[model samples]
Target: MGDDAPAALVEIVRRWADDPSLLVQRAAVAAICEPRLLKAEGAAAVAVDLCGRCTLHLVGLPLAERAGSDARTLRQALGYAWSVAVAADPGPGLGAFRDLDTSDPDVGWIVKENLRKKRLARLL
Candidate 1:
């Protein structure tokens, strides 16, 4: 889906990011985090946007709602996925990451995790 039509892939990823299922949300991040796919024109921006959306969803959930294995998996995927998108296009990618509400613990953790990556750490 990302090869011939990255925009369509982004749209689908957006929907998946908003899905109620945490695994589906994880899939959204995983799908867009592919380095090759992110190299596509404009794909990095969409990837960052979807990451932000998924992060927001996770942060908004109640504590109990976020404790499941699926949520943990999503969080783990997001830990490194942001760096991939930012590395692909730092301009919009970093801008989007900065736009996130990091005061939320989950969002803060995700930000910190991504910042730990050498790719994104070099930007800071």
Candidate 2:
């Protein structure tokens, strides 16, 4: 089981994409792991400081706190973390959507849950 944070992060990022706050932006950047994506410093620059903490939460800190035992779970967490950053990019499905500021409250937590499922698939 992936627990709740992955879905929570997805929902939180979905909100951020429409609004693009420094906190959300930074969290996305921290989750991002792709070298090519990270190379585009302009995108991640908004949250340099937050990235460090976010990285820990996604990869290490959270696991230590909960005594996370499953490698698959950790890997899935990594995948979701990267997804949050990737979704923030101005491309694909996310690019088509309005800015994070747009009120799509109807989007609901289901989308967040779906994202969690997709990330877990990567581990599978």
Candidate 3:
């Protein structure tokens, strides 16, 4: 997967981000959240995009649908993943994070969790 073209890789990640399975979505976030991967040219933007898609997937699910262990796994992965992407590309990354509608409890929790990260605190 890492050897694929950047555009193709991003597309694949997008699909994973959109997948119904929370474990698959967690994999997508974990795949791109690596600091080394984010250092590659244009990788940060791709990470931010994919992360945003994953967040949307979470936010769109009904509250009842998010009660499973799979959802918790995805939420846990996202809790710290935003910091990596934001540190990699503050402009687009922060923009994407800030663009989320935090009124939704899940989105609010994700945003608050990212804000608590020291990495993001230092960036801010």
Each prediction's total of clashing residue pairs, residues at least 3 apart in sequence or on different chains, is 0, 6, 0
lDDT accuracy of residue 108 in candidate 3? 85
- Runs in model 3 deviating more than 4 A are 1-11
Candidate 3 local lDDT, 44-122, one digit each (tens): 8878887888888887788888988888889888888988999999987887888888898877888899999988898
TM-scores of all candidate predictions against the true structure: 0.90, 0.24, 0.89
RMSD of each: 1.5, 15.7, 1.9
Candidate 1 achieves a global lDDT of 0.87
Error of 3 at 49 (Å): 0.7
lDDT (tens digit, per residue) of candidate 2 on 47-101:
2223323434333333344333443343334334444444434243233222222
Native-vs-model 3 lDDT?
0.84
Highest lDDT against the true fold, candidate: 1
Candidate 3 C-alpha error for residue 60, in Å: 1.1
In TM-score terms, candidate 3 sits at 0.89
- Residue 56 error for model 2, in Å? 5.9
lDDT per model vs. reference? 0.87, 0.36, 0.84
Tens-digit lDDT track for model 1 on 14-97? Answer: 889889998999999999999999988788887888788888788778899888788889888999899998888898888888
